[model samples]
Target: MTRTPEIAILGGGIGGLAAAAFLRRTGLPSTIYEQASELREIGAGLVMAPNVARLLRRLGVLEELAHHVVRLEIGWEFRRWQDGTVLSAENLAEACERLYGEHTYTARRSDLLAALRKSVPDDSVRLGKRCVAVIENGDRPALRFDDGEVAEADIVIGADGIHSVVRRVIADSIEATYSGLCAFRTLVPAEHAPEIARRNAHTLWLGPGHHLVHYPISAGKLINLVAIAPAGDYSVESWTARASIEEFLAEFDGWDPRLLDLIRAAETPGRWALLDRTPLRHWSRGPVTLLGDAAHPMFPFFGQGAAQAVEDAAVLAQCLAAQPDDPVNALQNYESLRIPRTTRLQEVSHGRSRINHLPDGPEQQARDKAFSDSDPLVDSAWIYEYDADTVPPFHIDTVAR
Candidate 1:
């Protein structure tokens, strides 16, 4: 940009709020525009992985998140569906501290969003400002909000989300392929969740073409349940759509009774379609760019969706701080630095569910046996150890490409 870029971030989601907070650490004055009139969490719970908590600690919100969310100490448990047998055990607490110097956390989405919003200025975030399209130019990019208000900035970040306007402006029109699976999510009271299964660990029950995963959130007051099942049609996608509990548990009929109990505890879960997107060729155009789900929307299979967005915010801030005078170069550096890592993660998360939800048969047993030699901690080392505080020189070398 010709002048010192006045940063304007679009979206008030977790990533956008984190972006504002991370930018504050870099001494850059930025504003966030959100479509919602009020700042609140839309979803139920989010897994605050080690990398995410470590990044928050750098942003100075560790104590706050720990105060509201359950500090997950036990590792995750992966088990067989028909006959309950230990398929894999992950020592999450030890693995994270050893790799990234923090423990993984499971907290309500509202708590994390609230903490991040607290870190930024109240006036800096303008709610109810729906963004329509971004107009890119030589250096400055202008944003036209739906309310007929036009705003311009040296760098306009499209943190808006999966259906991002900035992304449409930068990359070609990529389609979101329905994964033929609908996820039912709800937050249950930890007290009501069968006492035997209400532990701090993330418990996974793998079945035929489906799975159930739940963990403690809201300081153990609430447990977040996510049930994934194959569907004939995923024509609708909404986070607040009402779901039928009876219909949802039908998929888990042959699975263990424990899985059914989790479903029963949920009052009325929301039906969300699993939409997958192809990796974009570029994430930036001139001084305008994309972040969070706008840049990369990974499947929830890896449990790194929010974590990756947080990583994006932190790294974007780092790049801008590293090159304050050159907004265009810094934005380009941000894309080059992140494209490979995010793209690889997106691909990895895209189709890994097949292993978890093996169709019950000899194939299922063989698949389970194959994972016996795999190490969850070691296999996911690349994802869990990712850091944004420091920038290595051409670590993946996408800039040279």
Candidate 2:
């Protein structure tokens, strides 16, 4: 009889935690190694689209997430910048449930992390163990940590973020190209926001070379905001850099009064350069594999970054559980199933950046008119309806080729 593979997950971010939790559910043990002293999320808010919410429900964290999220009913409302005119809208609750069997939601990043962490076994996560390298050792691979300790596992999952150290173990190098854009993120108290802004809604204010996205989070007590614009004279990639309120406000000068009010009301805003990698051709080799941003880093225009990572965890666990006798083939199956879909998503998101940031012109006018005439739900149905748990069985024949 073949032995079950001992799994090691690098990173404790959402992807790594979800991977560990799902693996445990399949009776496969996985240890998560996070570089941070404690497993905490530094980011702000993200949407859990119906596709992801359904998976979280299956992973047993939907109830916990529900406690922290504002269940969104009306999906997305695209608005023209100057007058806050409605450009288009998506029926998130009714259409989503009718087609996808679930509702969408937005939540604080910490809450999502906490929920996934709670689902994982306490002893399974080892914090502060930064992986510097992964080296081949016979059938198993050994991970070298920054603390001068080496550990070996039958399988190593690189769930680390875009600049993953484990990615070096698979490919020699990869460059994360910047989008020449940066985003300012902050949270606003519901009491502080204007009445119109306080509604339980997801709004996008689009303008020339800039856009603003804000929605309620933390059970509707606070509002999460992200202002994206061209990165001129600022190119740092870290997410914790502080930005002056004046600089943030300057980008939206002469725009809608309500939108400007929210920017001015922000107490402290953090800025990060948007960087992404082209979809990789391969995500696994031998006993090593990549997951989440490490596998496919995408632009945030689609708001599916975290959702895709969570989906990766579910599909990966399913593949491994279905093929315990062959970890190598199982890893290949996971890559094949994910690459095409994720690659298409990457392309679509990049296209949105151009569409959302277009200068006032014929092209921009046509795009807005199209949105006004049609529901975005129809355009995004495939993504909303995707159920990774119920995906067709991955064929090993393709992997054996």
Candidate 3:
């Protein structure tokens, strides 16, 4: 009989916590090591698309998340930047539930994190432990932290973000290429926002070299806004970085007056540079593997970052539980099933950056026409219908157990 392997997950973000929660469901508990002193997420908004909603339901946190989220009756509403002409809109409340068996929702990033954190045991998380290096020591890989604490585990999963320490252990270091774009993110009290901004819809205004997206979150009490434009000289890549409202408005100088009014109502907007990294061909080495942004970081055009991380957590837990003793093989299986899907998403998201920022011309007109004709829910069926809990293990029969 094989013994259950000891698992150590780095980073206490959504991916890490979700991994722990899923593993617990399989009767395997893991520890999460986070760099920060507390487990919390920055103030931001994320689309809880059907794909993620399905997985969150399995984890039993979707109900708790529902309390803090705004269920979008309409989503992906595209409009012309200059005149606010409606290009396309999706009836998400009806179509999303009927087709995908889940409703599309939006919520504050912190609320989502808190919901995931609640599913994980408090003792499973170790705060203020910044991992500096990962050392391979035969079957037991060890993590070396900045505080000089060394710990070993039968398997180590890197749930850390883009700058993952464990990722360097398995893959060659690759420099991230700047996408030459930065985003201004802000939240407005729903009472102060424009009527359109307060609507239960996800709206995007597309134009030359930039685009802005906004939707109501926090159960319609707050409006979250994100505007992507040329980076210029700004290169900071932090969620907490500050930008004045004047700077934020300058980026969308000639946009519709309603959007400008919404921007003017923003308080303490955060600006961060958008960076893209080349996707890795492999994410597993020995007993260590990468998950979430550590494995495949992409542009936020698809709003699928958090969703992909949750998918990674669910699939990783499934693979590990299927082969508790042979952790290396299980890690490889996790990579095989995840890397291809995530790579496709990465490429598609990068391509969307160009589509969303096309200058006014025949090409942009054609793009708008395509949007008007295609239904987003139908087009994204492949993504929304995936169930991580039931996805077949990659080449499970071929691997010797």
Per-residue lDDT of candidate 3, residues 103-151 (tens digit): 9889998898999998988888899999999999989999999999999
List ranges where model 3 is wrong by over 4 Å: 397-401
Prediction 1 global C-alpha lDDT: 0.81
* C-alpha RMSD of each candidate structure in angstroms: 2.2, 1.3, 1.5
Query: What are the runs in model 1 whose C-alpha is more than 4 Å off?
Result: 1-3, 393-401
Per-residue accuracy of model 1 over 152-225 as CA lDDT, tens digit each:
88888889887788887888888888788878888887767786468888877788888888888888888888
Report the CA-based lDDT of candidate 3 relative to the real structure: 0.90
lDDT of each: 0.81, 0.87, 0.90
Superior candidate under TM-score, 1 versus 2: 2
Clashes of 1: 0
Better of 1 and 3 by TM-score: 3
* Cα lDDT for residue 246, candidate 1: 86
Q: Which residue pairs clash in candidate 1? A: none
Model 3 CA lDDT for position 69: 92
For residue 187, what is the lDDT in candidate 2? 89
Ranking by lDDT: 3, 2, 1
**Residue 194 lDDT, candidate 2, scale 0-100:** 73
